[model samples]
Target: MSDSRSGLFGFVLNGLGHMFRGGLLYWAWLALLLVLIVLGGWHYYLQLRDGLLVTNMSNQVSWGFYISNFTFLVGVAAAAVMLVVPAYIFNRKDIKDVVLMGDTMAIGAVAMAILFVVVDLGRPDRFWHLIPFIGRFNFPESMLAWDVIVLNGYLLLNFGISFYIVYNHYQGKEPNASRYFPWVLLAIFWAISIHTVTAFLYSANSARPYWHNALLAPRFIASAFASGPALMAIGLQIIRRVSDYPIRQSVIDHLALVAAIALQVTLFFVLAELFTDFYNEGEHAASARYLFFGLDGHTALTPWIWTAVLLLAVALLILMIHPLRTHPVYMNIAFVLTVVGVWIEKGMGLVIPAFVPTPIGEIYEYAPSATEIMVSLGIWAIGLLLFTLLAKAALPVQCSFLREKAHREVTHDDA
Candidate 1:
């Protein structure tokens, strides 16, 4: 047992050493990550000194790109549950191959989501007040407090499950059965809770007609599944090109299927919203008009929204066609485009429309201030850096550990 433990320690250290000595692409990515971190840190300092006034966010447009990114990332985080359910619960082999990748992506996305909220807060320093036991939770009433609980809980669930799986592989053992099965169940429920709570956060604001509908939760889930699978597909392609890890083409095909279904659901919900707005012709219709057309003398965001719709159509077309979806190059291009298009739609498109005819009947537009943009970029850089290092250390074990253990078992049996 001690020998086995020592071997595992050596394996981890060796993986780290290899990453430091890895190819130019690895070094280049790390360097770019460092630059982003420095710039982001500097911007955060400026924001601290200048305050929220530095941001284009006014009383009308209180939530801007920051909140948009937060909303989008929560979906990304929830998408991992899709993979988790299939792999661990239903035992789907096609998704099992890429489950670790999905798990890693979830970790990265959740970390970024939390960072966005921290940066957006009026008093970032007071964020520590949410710490469990030490902080006031005001439960059963405050939806925001519930959001904090669900988000943090979901993060822990993902991290714990991922860590156990990786560590077990490192030790040449399959994960403990008791631990694995329970977390799988936890992950499934936690997945729904995270996105549902996020939607509830918006819907709870009855004054915000655009977000008040009962359909918000379903819409959020639909958007999340679409964008999340698209991102996973893109990440898989990157891993395939960069490393020796084997990702079966069959797995890519399965993810493509998921992306297609998600896109369809997203389109359905969006159309439903349009129908409700046009059919009703109330304040809600007026809000929808600003999003689809233009109102209050504001037309800057209309073109971008149309562009997002066109890109979504393109993505759907690519996925719906068999040849396009299966062709690696074309599929990859479509996946990247879809991810970017959704980010724009969910981040900028969703945010701007909510504030169109402000509560006080004035128009307010929001663009991320230089400091806000820089701080956001920095958080992204940090997430990338953490993920890169984690992949550097963890990927090797995942790729070879199981095979190594099998070989050892065969040797022992022969002996």
Candidate 2:
């Protein structure tokens, strides 16, 4: 027991030590993250003191930048399933190399999503009201409560799995396959639930017709699959360039293919929703009109949505081409474009218009104030910082471990 404790202590201490020892670019990135976090903290301080009034969010559009980000990140967090299911279940060696990175990404994303929720709350001090033991947490009854529950569970699953595997690797031992497999399976299903519950949080709002649709949850999942893996594809490239780990081309190829399919599905769902909205020409269609084109001289969100659509189309074109998908240069560019396209589509494009020509027939245009923008960027900074630290610590150890294991196998074969 004493030896085990010492080993664990050494594992954590060694990992953290290497994470801080990075080159100039790493320090620059860390500096940038710190600046954003501090700036965001300042804005949040103002918000707490002055209330939601510090931002442009109003009674008509109660959810602004924070909720939109929360929505998008929930999908990103869930997207880790794209890697987890294949790597753990099928035991795809190519993907197994990078699966821990995906799970770590999930950890950062879930943490950021939770922070967004807490920040959006006007009275964060009363947060205990949402806790089961301390307050009236309406679990199973409140969709929000369900979101809280599942999100934390998903975080725990990812953090536990990622840490356990990496710990085993650090100890120069193969993890017990049986021990990790069930948890991997849990993460897969839980990923789906987290995003679905998030969608339901919006769809269940009977008053918001823009959100009250069966297709909303499906669209969320589709875009999530596209955006999350697209982000992961780019991340894998970054990891390979900076580290000794040789991420296989086959893994990148598979991710590109999956992202292409997922992006296609996202586009299809958007068209399906548009058809359902305009074809029937009901009261609900107003928000759709407000989004795609201008309605009643209100066109604030039009350009943004159209631009998202254009970028998605461009990204798809590049991703669909066999040669382009295989070329690292082209695929990485496409991946970035897809990430931006989805961010706009799911963030400002989806949320703003829905609230526009709001439920009470208020045609007021919603725009994020400077404070909101700063705070949003700050939350993102926090996520990136978390991811950067996690990858820095985990990757080198895992990569070296995989290398040693490979060398041993080859030696044994020769013997």
Candidate 3:
């Protein structure tokens, strides 16, 4: 018990140290994030003060960037399961070292996804209306309610499993967390379900032919895997450089393999969409037209969409080439570009399609208002800040364990 308390104290102090010592870049990022949050808050205040008329979103483009971000993040959160299944279940020793990092990132991603939903709400104060017992369950009938349950359940699963692993490490015990293996499996299925439900949320609204296809769910999964792993690869690279943590080259090589496969799958889905849309020559094709060329007189989004596609192609090419994927500098560049490309593709691509050929057969384009952009930035900042602090606290222990293992090996060699 005394040792447990000491460990807890040490954890708290270590976290505080990271908070202070996270350096100028960390603080600068935090400041930028805070500024965005403040600006978003002020914009939201004006929104509340003036009403929904503050921005361009109407009955046609009701969802906009917030909803798009929400959907994309669901995929991001689900990507963690890819890492977990291989490391914990298959006993992939290379990934074993970084599985905990994957879990920690899942927690942050899910939290941010939920935050985007909250910000997008017309009446965010009424968010508690979904609470069980206290609020209505409306199960089976309400997709939103289902989303709440699955998302919260998945969040708890991640938090529970992650805390268990970290706590055991703190006590210098081999985690008996294997008992929760079934729960981890359950979480994996739940991860898929969360993203599927998100896709369904858009698809079920049959009026929006752009999102109405059966392919949305599978495409979402593919995109999630590609973007999520790309982000993770970049994250691992950063940790390796900044701290004493020793992520093996083999681990990076394997991750690149995963990224490569996911990128291929995502590209296939994109091509499939093109084939379906052009072949059909239907209203659905209109959305693709808006994305590729322009719709009516609006071409604002076309250039940006093509730019993202170009970057994605470049990133995918780098990942496919063995020399580029193995090189630290090139791999990191590819990962960063891939993540940015996906964000643009998912954020604008998903939302704008729904607005084209509006309900009355009109087209309206959305550019996020200053306030909306700030709010989004704020949320992103919060995710980074949270991950930074958590990484600071958790990484030291993992690094220490790896160092001890290296020392043991060296001692054995000497003997």
How far in Å is the alpha carbon of 338 misplaced in model 2?
A: 0.8
| Best prediction by lDDT | 2
Kindly list the per-residue Cα lDDT of model 2 for residues 1-415, writing each as its tens digit. Answer: 2366439888888888988999999999999999999999999999999889988988888888898898889999999988888887787988988898899899999999999999999889999898887899887899999999999999999999998999988878899989988888888999999999999998998888889999999999999999999999888888888888879878888889989999999999998988888887889898889888888988888888889998999899999998888887889888998999999999988787778887879888888899999999999999999999999999888878998999999999999
* Candidate 3 global TM-score: 0.92
Per-residue alpha-carbon lDDT of candidate 1 for residues 60-132, written as tens digits (9 for 90 to 100): 8888878888888998989987788788888886677669888888888888999899988989888778876
Which of candidates 2 and 3 reaches a greater lDDT?
Answer: 2
Q: Which stretches of candidate 3 lie above 4 Å from their native place? A: 1-4, 7-18, 21-29, 405-415
* TM-scores for every candidate against the unseen true structure: 0.94, 0.97, 0.92
The better-scoring model by TM-score among 1 and 3 is 1
> What are the RMSD figures for all models against the true structure?
2.4, 1.6, 2.4
Candidate 2 lDDT score relative to the true structure: 0.90
Instruction: Tell me how far the alpha carbon of residue 7 in candidate 2 is from the true structure, in angstroms, after superposition.
Output: 1.7
**Model 3, range 323-388, lDDT digits (tens) per residue?**
988888888888887788888888878877777868568887877777677677777777776777
Q: For candidate 2, what is the TM-score?
A: 0.97
lDDT of residue 13 for candidate 1: 71
Of 1 and 2, the candidate ranking higher by lDDT: 2
**Global lDDT of each model?**
0.82, 0.90, 0.80
